[model samples]
Target: MDAPERHPRIVVGVDGSDASIAALHAAGSLAGPLGATVEAWACWDVPPGYGLYLVVGIEGFEYAARQSLEQALADAFGPELPAFVHPRVVRGKASEQLIEGSRNASLLIVGRRGHGSLVLGSVSSACVSHAHCPVLVVHAPEEAAHRKKGSHARKSDDGQ
Candidate 1:
């Protein structure tokens, strides 16, 4: 008898940014073809200046982070997120959390740029260098459109 196939994990980093939203959709699109489960991780760090305030404010911080992750999903996948995708909010650095998650995941996906930068974000750079699994950095819409148009031009030149 054949062994049952194991469901693979596709972990994505979300931060309520356009890039992250794109990554979420890219993960969902890939999971459908690969028969994998999508795990959305949102990380938040308390400001260093808040010492004792950090303890008292932890709950509120976590709540906001969780809500942001939920909203990103809602924005990406409409009112209800797909059943195969699971959302998680954790307290930690975004890069560290995502790298840890990559340990057991089949694929790790992130956006080329998150909420922080006009250029590539630090988390994406770290993931590319350190994730245990294969990493896919989804580009912003403008970049994707440019890439698509370039590829189309190349294909047309072949006269097929």
Candidate 2:
């Protein structure tokens, strides 16, 4: 007898930013109708420069990172995640880890900007360049607001 096929996954990079939250929603929306799973990924890393500081309390850092991922997932979805969605916290650079995790995913989703910058974030840029699957970069809320304001301004100018 043949084994049953597993459900496909829609991988998403999440970091508690407004953009990441948007990406999570996008992934969930896509996963629902497709009967796919949503993998919410978050990575935490400490450079060699911070080793001394980390050595004093590495366990705490790990705990906090895991908590952050869990909290982000809860905040985006709810206290209880849907059966199709799950959260994972990995230890590595965001871009590299996310790229590796999305290898078997049907779609890889990320926010255009994370907590790092006002513009496009490095992780999103790296994922766009090197993801194994199709990539979807969701825009930040502020960017949507800006676009809306710009369109309204254009309409006023046209009316003048």
Q: Which prediction has the highest lDDT against the true structure?
A: 1
Find the candidate with the highest TM-score and give its number.
Answer: 2
Compose the digit string of candidate 2's lDDT tens values, residues 49-75.
887867586666567777877877877
Q: For candidate 2, report its TM-score.
A: 0.84
**Model 1 lDDT per residue over 1-160, tens place:** 9998778999999988888899998998999999999999999888678898765767877888899999999989999779999999888989999999999999999998744444567899899899999999988788779769999999999985
The 0-to-1 C-alpha lDDT of every candidate, in the order given, reads: 0.89, 0.84
Any runs in candidate 2 off by more than 4 Å, and if so which?
1-6, 114-119, 158-160
Residue pairs clashing in model 2 are: none
- What TM-score would every model get versus the actual structure? 0.82, 0.84
Lowest summed lDDT over 10 consecutive residues: which window, candidate 1?
112-121
Looking at model 2, report the run of 10 residues with the lowest lDDT sum. Answer: 112-121
Clashes of each: 0, 0
